[model samples]
Target: MKTIKGNFIFDKEENKEKIDEFKKFIEKNKDRKGPLMPILQEGQNVFGYLPEEILKLISSKLNIPLAEIYGVATFYSQFTFIPKGKTDIHICLGTACYVKGGADILEEFEKRLNIKKGETTEDRKFSISETRCLGDCGKAPVVEINGKQLAHFTKEDVKKVLEKYK
Candidate 1:
């Protein structure tokens, strides 16, 4: 039906071989009753993220309830249903960091990126977020870029780090 973002769009001709492979895997594991995770993992790897249609297809193929499939996916934080940006910026909002201008840093990031928390830029390069703590409160006002942490920064420091993405 309607095309959905962060979801699967079927292409029979392009995916024929892969779909056949998945069918085999499902059939082989049909009797085992624990193939859901493996199937979803593989699906996410192939598709970058698990879409609703793909989950349904998986549930139907495995004879697992759709609710269980969805529940499992939603239960795990490791599993991402939405497509992720190339670079992730996590600004800590921990108490130490907060007083040290964490909020201001976040605000500056929003102003520069022109995207709010949980939103990916149109180019899909930057995904700015706020997190509770990065476990380095001593380095108050920390900003993590693509998993690397830089702490004890000023507003200018935030700007310079983000400008590299452009």
Candidate 2:
């Protein structure tokens, strides 16, 4: 296994296979009218997150500048540079949730996990993110862990919730 950019770990053989897969995808899509976005999206899908090497490969293959690719990737919130942890934690910061102490719940998560929003723990056990809404405003201050919603969440519940995952 090899680690790329000190964050992504992969088996050398597996990485080669993914690179080959991405290369084929690029070949099929490179000549499309607007190929960059699709290629970047597919690259992220292939690698879990877009690392520098993959971006550079896309640039080289498409004859596009690396900066242009980075610009496009950064402009969209849908794309992330860091890989998500095995467990994803999303705290809703919608109007209702934020008013109901959702921000405080998020702070508690950061403190407990020792990682800021949009970051994964060093061990990659958990990643924390914020969502505009969870569509259950009636149960304000919601926290979704691994796609399971915990509605009406509070800071005090953080420990108990985390313990369940542990």
Candidate 3:
């Protein structure tokens, strides 16, 4: 229960509703066969991210050990323990993109946003991530801002591109 940055502490009044919903969801699925994964996924969908509290609830309600829940969550990249930002910036770092200065584009984004890869900005306005591939290597060095692809990106365009989000 140590405080981890970005994971919502479920004790907040605002999170009560979400916590209740998570409990209900777990209860509804408790009778199903091999329900842990689906319950975890639904909890993430409901809460936006799988914070510690939600996992604890799932584990307690399902009669599964906390370590087992943690193990399953960690095994899947689809489950993020931390909260995502308002805008998710995915910079491609695949072989094609990297060969074409994608790494430089990623660095520029980190510098401009003041956050390293996989970290969200303090204001929560943006999260910078290094994506394996954006599926558009033809336009190598592709950047996706909030799921909107920006192909053939350049460092000079960084300021202008970010300004649009602001």
Candidate 4:
């Protein structure tokens, strides 16, 4: 099986290095109080996204139930099960941004990228997601690409911004 972003599921052979890294992370941190969160975060960092195999590994090493691990991971919006594209786009939907045509900007991205929010393109070049706020209300309609913010973004700017990544 593969994830929506085309990452193979349970292909441990292909992910041996990342799995080893995650194992080291787990060994180094497993004894700490409240280690699950950090373990999961590091797992995501190492694997790009947490797959079932990693989750199961965590459960086995920590002796935590798989269901419990899933519960915690799912509760956090920061954890994503699917691989994010190389260029991740986040559009703010905060009140200020929405009022400034943020929705239109998001629509423009969807139209141009041919993928809805929370989905990565088939080629894995881009992924679109939305946030409630980007804390740049003054700029309104903020678009964040790989951690860099594009303030006062307009629908017309999407093409140019995407060109930079391409």
Best by lDDT: 2
What's the distance in Å from true for residue 28, model 1? 6.5
lDDT value, residue 92 of candidate 4: 96
Off by over 4 Å in 1: 6-47
> Candidate 2: where are CA atoms >4 Å away?
1-12
- Residue 33 CA error for candidate 2 (Å)? 0.8
Instruction: Please report how far candidate 4 places residue 76 from its true position, in Å.
Output: 0.8
Best of the candidates, TM-score = 2
TM-score order, best first, reads: 2, 4, 3, 1
lDDT (Cα, tens digit) per residue for candidate 1, span 102-153: 9999888888889887666777778788888899998898999889999897
Where's the lowest-lDDT run of ten residues in candidate 4? 1-10
**lDDT score, candidate 4:** 0.89
lDDT at 24, model 1 = 80
TM-score of 4: 0.88
- lDDT of candidate 3 over 113-141, digit per residue (tens): 98888777776788888889889999988
lDDT of each: 0.78, 0.89, 0.83, 0.89
Clashing pairs in 1: none
* Model 2 worst lDDT run, 10 consecutive residues: 3-12
| Model 3 TM-score relative to the real fold | 0.88
Candidate 4 displacement at residue 23 in angstroms: 0.7
